[model samples]
Target: MNGTLTTALAAGLGTGLALIVAIGAQNAFVLRQGILREHVAAVVAICALSDVVLIGLGIAGVGGVVRLWPAALTVVAILGSAFLLTYAALAARRALNPSAMPMSENATTRGRRAVAATCLALTWLNPHVYLDTVLMLGSVGNGFGDLRWWFAAGAALGSLLWFTALGYGARLLSGLFTRRRSWRILDGLIAVIMATLGIGMLTNALR
Candidate 1:
């Protein structure tokens, strides 16, 4: 068990570090929530947990499943596009009504859950994630064919550590969200980002 921990940690940390440092949809959403201090802990947990699940699946050979069902990628692309567009519309609404933020706790919870679920969907549902994390990361981890598991373990741990720190650390800026204008601006930006990403994915799928 101890040895397996080391292997998992190494592989997880190595793979995790590579992707964790990169700027992507999940990180962007997490950072935004952190700044707003809305469900910071939940947001972080979701993001990290999502990564863990993906990485684990990758290591467990789900990458092969993804490879077999290429069309599933298209399905994910479509769903992700719709979700992003919807969220964007909501964000635009928030921009219009700044008070809607604090007064909307249940809404926030729903939004957070939606966002987290989206993050998971976006991360796992995409074939690219499997290609990178599972195929590539797994292959790399097994480099020496001996210490490869160690690499994967490290990668996973890196993701856990990075997401936790990022989500929590971003909350330090919660003070700025106090202003209605700030909320408007932030929400508006989120809307734009989500819409843009969604549209981009849709376009890619169409291509």
Candidate 2:
């Protein structure tokens, strides 16, 4: 039993890390907030907690229900694609306006409320979050049968670790991002990522 539990935990951790490590809009937002050093803790908390809830639901068999109604994902895909495209446009605009890329204390400061809102939106509005955490992770966890809860716990730990590291570890890149050019590059990459993801979802939905 002990060996089986350990295997399940390791499997969950690996799966969680593999899915979360991708460069999605949520991650891009988190990275930007981390670089700006604005409301990092709040952003991290919202993202990590949101994952916990979603993963819990998934392991509880919400994944099977979601799979039964493919139309629900279609709706999510459409809405998520629209949101990503809008965010991509904003990121592109920011990239073009170097004046907006300053890392100075005065320039980077943003309201905690606004930051939290964006963080939540980025996490919750993305359809991939549902597909990954709720459906994929949940389905995988169920494979553990009676030990599925252990798998969920391990996945949740992975999320907590990843977000904590991403939110705090980004400060280490502060020196590099001090330049407007660096910010431009980062924002440009974000724009590309968002656009690509949005288009991909749109395509998938239409299929």
What are the TM-scores, per candidate, against the unseen true structure?
A: 0.78, 0.94
Candidate 2: pairs in clash:
none
Per residue, candidate 2 scores C-alpha lDDT tens digits across 1-207 of 689999999888889989998878898899988888888999999999999999999999898788788898888888888988998998898899876665634455679998898788778877778889999999999999999999998999999999999999999999998788899999999999999999999999989
Residue 187 Cα positional deviation in candidate 1, in Å, after optimal superposition: 1.8
The lDDT of model 2 is: 0.89
Task: Indicate which candidate wins on TM-score.
Answer: 2
Model 1 segments more than 4 A misplaced? 1-15, 103-119, 122-127
Write one digit per residue (lDDT tens) for candidate 1, span 164-199: 888888877678766777777877788888788888
TM-score of 2: 0.94
